[model samples]
Target: MLVIFPACSVFRFQVSQGKIIDPPWRPSIAGMIRRTKATVVPVYFEGMNTLLFGILGILKPRLRMFLLPREIIHQTGKTFKLKIEQPISYENLFEQKLQSDVEIINYLRQRTYHLAHRI
Candidate 1:
């Protein structure tokens, strides 16, 4: 920030030191008409398309279904996987009793900490 501020100030002073902007070419009559046509045509088409589709999508069920994902499945089948297909988080153990190794490790940890603090 300290480095950028002084450079920005210097650039601002140079621009304020008298200079005038001149466009390199004056627009010809044909160029102006082409620019106007290019701007108007796409805007008119977009507005008309938006209004046409907006009404049709609301009035037509098939068109609306084509535009949106259908909630109902065309085919139904029961899942037959016997075990979890994805990796599981250890947090699921919170609802169950701690396994034997976990209890042993925790007991050792507390015993070591208590002995060290007592000494």
Candidate 2:
């Protein structure tokens, strides 16, 4: 099974001024990884937040919020970039000497953001 975890607990719209937020990632994902020995693939989407904000800008905020799902489904002619890094082996994760599950998750979170910056 594939499990997707966001680096932050909060949504992008919760922040003001379109600032990039780096709230602490939930550590439960790391625990799950350790228990299941799941290989992790760090993935980052660069333009998704911008697209959402741009849509909000064009339409009334409240109405847009309600229509966001439909807008995303029906809208066309927009491009976004995504980067999927090489998978991290379950053994490799322990070999890193991260000290704790939280640290392992933090390491993965850093790699994901690094991908975002590079893209």
Candidate 3:
């Protein structure tokens, strides 16, 4: 989905819905689950999202360069050691950027909480 912005034409909101597509072949239920086990997280969806977005912010250019259709590429990269040319330095800039991110997260969390519990 695209949302037109009066301020900036480049800014748009795109969202994708979950879908199950038909495959040419079918697998046993157990086999399917086994195949997906490596990617499946039985708990803590919030933490998973935080980790994902944090990595995304740190590596947006590299992320965009090796663009895949879905988030699967990022997940699979984690399983193997990726020898990226300009790997993110978690030493210096990370601390500064991370502080900013933490502030934004806290601000958003507080705003959401207040919105939910508005009197």
Candidate 4:
């Protein structure tokens, strides 16, 4: 399935300011996973946000690519890294019903936060 960012979520950041903000994770995702019995794979990308290029992207709103200008995006003078955690089973998530959608979202956000902090 394609990854789509719902409104008021990650893409709304002003400047890739090296901060981790947890926007609401739509419950619909959980619902869909439950319906389809799919595993939720959390993939984290580090350094995907470069301040200047990220600001440009925020301003432009149309030129949407993981990286805007190849040069400036990496101009932060930092290298990038990617982390992929083990797929989270929907069955397991459903079994653990105590965690709400917001909690699940925050958990995922924390995963990303830890991943970002590496760099």
RMSD in angstroms, candidate 2? 4.3
Sorted by TM-score (best first), the order is: 2, 4, 3, 1
Every candidate's lDDT: 0.27, 0.71, 0.30, 0.58
lDDT of 4 by residue, 1-119 (tens): 75644323344454566653445667666556556877777767555455655566667755535444564545565766677777778776667663666665556556555665563
For each candidate, how many residue pairs have backbone atoms clashing (under 3 Å)?
Answer: 0, 0, 0, 0
Question: Which ranges in model 2 have alpha carbons more than 4 Å from their true place?
Answer: 8-18, 50-71, 74-77
Better of 3 and 4 by TM-score: 4
State which candidate, 2 or 4, has the greater lDDT.
Answer: 2
Question: Of the candidates numbered 1 and 4, which has the greater TM-score value?
Answer: 4
Global CA lDDT computed for model 4: 0.58
TM-score of each: 0.17, 0.69, 0.18, 0.54
Best by TM-score: 2
Worst 10 residues of 3 by lDDT: 3-12
Ordered from best to worst lDDT, the candidate numbers read 2, 4, 3, 1
| Deviating ranges (above 4 Å) for candidate 4 | 1-23, 57-79, 117-119
Query: In order, what is each prediction's RMSD in angstroms?
Result: 33.7, 4.3, 20.4, 5.3
lDDT by residue for model 3 (1-119), tens: 22111111111112232331112122232233334332211111111223444345345635522333354444564543222122212343233343443443333233333432333
